[model samples]
Each structure stands twice: as C-alpha cells, then as structure tokens.
Target: MDQIIELFRHLINPAWIIDNGGLYLLIAIIFAETGLFVGFFLPGDSLLFLAGFYGNELSASFHDAPFVVLMLLIAVAGVLGNMVGFWFGRKSGPMLYNRKDTFFFKKKHLHQAHDFYEKYGGGAIFFARFLPIIRTFAPIVAGIVGMDRKKFMFFNLIGSFAWVFSMMLAGYFLGKKFPGLKDHLELIVIGLVVVTTFPVLFKLLFGKAKGPIKTEAAKATEESESK
Candidate 1:
C-alpha cells in the first residue's frame, strides 16, 4: 500500500518522471492524458515544460540533434492520443450522453466538452489541447458529434504540434538561457498550471451556458416591465 502511494506521488513529480522514465514515460503520459478519460488528472502542461527543460538529458540517447527528436516524439504521442479518444467517442456514440458518472467520469465534463464543441465548432479540439481537463475530453466530444475524420485530423495534427513545440520550446530555450531556472521547478509548474487552468475554470464557472437562465431578480424585473 505504501509503495503504491509512493509511486503515485512520484508520478506527479515532473523531475522524478524525467529522472526515472525519461523519454519513454513522458510519451506514455502524454498519450494517456490526452486519450484516456481517467487520465485527466495527469500532468500535461508541466510535464511538457519539464520535458523541454531537460531536453538534452531526455534526448541524450539521440545525439546530433538537441530538442528536435524530443519535440517530435511528444507531438506524435499527443496526436495519436487524441486520435484514440476520437475513436473511443466514435465507437461509444450517443450512448456516452446517457451514461452515468462514476469515480473516473463526470457528466458535467462531457456536457462542458459538448458546449465547447458546439461553440467552437472544430477548433475546440485545437484549443482544448491547452486546457487540462477539457483537453482530455475535447477530442472525445469531437468524435461524439461526428466531426469529419479528415477535419479532426487537421486540427489534431496542428494542435498537437503547436501545443508540444510551444510548451517544450518555451522550457527548452528558457532553460538554455537560464540554467538556474531548473532550481525553481515548483514555481514554474505552478505558474504553468495557473496559466493553462485558469481559463478553463473561468469558462466553466462563468462562461455562458447553452442558454441564459433567468435569475430571481431578472424574473422580477421582467414581470414588472411586463406589467
């Protein structure tokens, strides 16, 4: 039991992940986080950033190239991950809508993903890659809505490349310029989490839903105006 607990603790630690699993584990986590519904809790933004921060070390197996191989592999993993999620949603179809929530599933997230898809059309898949929880579900929702396979792949490829390179390169270049930046991994991770998550939380908590619901005050005002 203690060993299992300890392992999970280490799993969330980006430094430990790089030190232990290096390139392979990083790719697996990226795939799971984007592809698996239960994997929504896994670190995404921070992991990518840290992978970039340790690009040379992670990519040490590949000489002659610095961060190129690292970035490309991660990008492929991300793309493939979304494809899997899309396939799952496509297979599951509307049945997913009727399914009850469980420990690993939440109806609200599915609903939010649906709303996001409705509002953004096909771009939600691309945009959701930056948002944590939604990133996991956006591709699934794309499949559920029966988004064209070619169109989904279009956004999936571009979004995967964009997300991977942006996050990784940011860390890669910054770490290259400032060696001491690694000393503050906690701070960097926190900042990245806030930057990526705040928008999603904001949208969930405050973004307009499918239709406006009238407040008591709104109802009173409408009644008075009608009178």
Candidate 2:
C-alpha cells in the first residue's frame, strides 16, 4: 500500500514527471485525461506548463523547431483524447437515456443536458479545455447530447490548439526568460489548480439560484403535451 501510494505521488509531481517519462508520458497523460473518464485526477494543466518549462530537454531530439513539434504533438494528443471521450459518450448515451429513473436519476436532467449542449456546446467545448475536471467531461457530455460531429470536431481542433499552445508556450517563454522560475513550480501549480477549479465550483454552487431556465426544446415539448 505504501509503495503504491508513493508511486502515485511521484506521478503527480511535475518535476518527477519530467524526469521519468518526459515527453511521451506527458502526451499519454493528456490523452488519457481528455478521453478516459478515469483520468480526471491526473495533473493536466500543470504538467503541460512544466513540459514547456522543460522544453529544452524534452524537445532536444527534435533538433529543428523543437518547441513547435512538442506543442503540436501535445495538441494532437488532446484532440484524439476528446474524440475518444465523445465516442464513449455516444456509445453509452442511449443506455443512459433508456434506463429507468431511480432516486438519483431523472430524465428531465438528461433533456436539459441535451438542450444545453445544443445551445452552448461549441463554447463549452472551447472553454472547458482550460478548466480542470470540466474539460474531461465536456466532450463526453457533448457526445451524450448528440452534438453534431462536424461542429464538435471543428471546436475540438481549435480548442485543443488554443489550450495546448497557450499553456505550454506561456511556460516555455517564462522559463526561457527566467532561469530560476522553476524553483517556484509548486506555487505555480497550486495557483493553476485554484484558478481553473474555483470558477467551476462557483458556477455549480450559485449559477442555479434563479432555478433552471426553460429552454426552447422544453417549451416545445410542453406545447406538444398540451395539445
């Protein structure tokens, strides 16, 4: 048990991550986190930042335009990861919808999710990439709601590019300019977590004070029922 715990600890440690698997492990984690439901606990934003911080070493084998290569590889992994999530969600969505509502489940919520995705799916996919936990599930939810494949792909590509490049490049440039910056990686990681997490918590806690806004689909359903 102790050995397993310690191994898990090292996996989350950014410095340890860079030292051990370097680029490939980083890529794999990104893929897993974005696609696999089980990867929500893995360190993502901080890992990308640190990968950029250690770009010189990680990118060494590439020789020419190493930073660009590193960013593209990571971005592609992210895109593929989201695609996997979407596939899983799509495969399982019908089962979820067909299942009888229990004490913990309600069909209305599913309809609401469908409506919400129809309206804001694109923006959610784009922005969720920056928010931990949320990013992992957003694509899956998009799949559940039957979001248009072409639309999902368009945003997936753009969002993955934006998220990977922004986080990694920020670290790369900062590390280049300040040689001693990595000394404060712990503080930076904490800040990234807080920044990404707080908004999600706030939205969940307070965004519903006014109650659920009636969506057009809900209204249409109501009208049909009345008829």
Candidate 3:
C-alpha cells in the first residue's frame, strides 16, 4: 500500500507535469480524462491541485505562463472533455456496457453515474465534476439517456467552471500557503479522493429507488374516475 501510494505521489507531482508536457499536456490530460473512457485511471483532482500547488514553479519554468488564464483554459478543457464524452456516449454507449470490468475499468462506475443522472437529471452533470470517476461518466450517461444538448452544455459549462476553477484555484492558493503539504501528498491525495467519493458511495449504497413513483392517492383517484 505504501509503495502504491508513493508511486502515485510522483504521478501527480506538479514538477513532473511541468517537466513533462507543461500547459498543453495538462489541458490534454484533463480533456482526455473526462472525455475519453480510456482516461479513467488518470488522477484528475491531484493533478489540478498540483498545478495550483506548484503554480509559482510552473510559471518560473515556463516563463510567461499566465496562471489564472491557464486555469480558465483548463476549465475549458474539462468542459470540452465532457462534451466530447457526451457525444461518445451517444455514439458508443452500447459497446461500453458490453466491455467487462477490469482492474482499470468498472461497469459499476458507469451504473453509479447513471443513477446520479437519473436521480438528479441535469444537476448531476454539475455534481459529478467534483467526483473522480463519476465525473468521467456523468456526461456520457447524460448522452446515453439522450439529454438535450443545450441542457447538457448549460450544466456542463457551469459544472466545468465550478469543478476546474474551484479545485485548481484552491490547490494553487492552498499550495502557496501550506507548501509543506506536498511532502505528504499521498495522504492529502487519498484524503481528498475519499472525501469527494464518499457522497457518491453513500448515495449508491443507501439511496432509495428514485424511479417513477406512483402516489397511492393518485392511483386511488384514477381508479375512482375509472369506476
């Protein structure tokens, strides 16, 4: 477990991101993670936070990197990613269910995301942005259900702004203040991931059936009218 966590520690390191592909790569990953099914394994929250945490270093190295502007662009990337994912779901949702679950992928995640959309409708698109894997699947589920594109885009725009800016900005500022947190990043990342995922988990395990409910009073009224 320790080894695994340690490995992940490096995976989301801001310096690694900068040294690797910098702004473009970051945006691409953010898009791919949310838009592409194959991107399910990428650590999004940690990466965004890391960008904020290491904003100074990143700017210094990149020389002319616009910190806030980059974040906004990242937000755009996230929104666009979901939009693409929505289209993918519309086109390929059938094949998706056919593929079996693996260590890297789980049909359960899609089902859970589907439930979120069913229960909350357009709102789930906004909500799912905060959750990791669910964020990836949320837009897709919206597509599968054939949600209006306008509604999806509206919710997607709002959710993307909320998710990307809020998270990345928080990371950037928090990182500036608590610079030491990065040393214990595995713990921080785990805690963040757990806290965010808890709501999804709670809803899935304990949530009541939200499928169409016929009220007893309505049923009685209909029967009386029929009689």
> Relative to the true structure, how large is the alpha-carbon lDDT of every model?
0.82, 0.75, 0.79
lDDT of residue 69 for candidate 2: 88
TM-score, one value per model: 0.83, 0.77, 0.80
lDDT by residue (tens digit), candidate 1, 142-170? 77767899999999999999999999999
lDDT-wise, the better of 1 and 3 is 1
Q: What's the lDDT for residue 151 in model 3?
A: 93
**Which model is ahead, 2 or 3, in terms of TM-score?**
3
Give the C-alpha lDDT of model 2: 0.75
- On lDDT, who's better, 1 or 2? 1
Q: Residue 50 CA error for candidate 3 (Å)?
A: 1.3
Cα lDDT of model 3 overall? Answer: 0.79
lDDT of 1 at 201: 87
C-alpha lDDT of residue 19 in model 3: 82
CA RMSD for every model?
7.7, 5.0, 6.0
> Which pairs, if any, clash in model 3?
52-172
Q: How does model 1 score by TM-score?
A: 0.83
Identify the runs in model 3 with alpha carbons over 4 angstroms from their true place: 1-7, 201-227
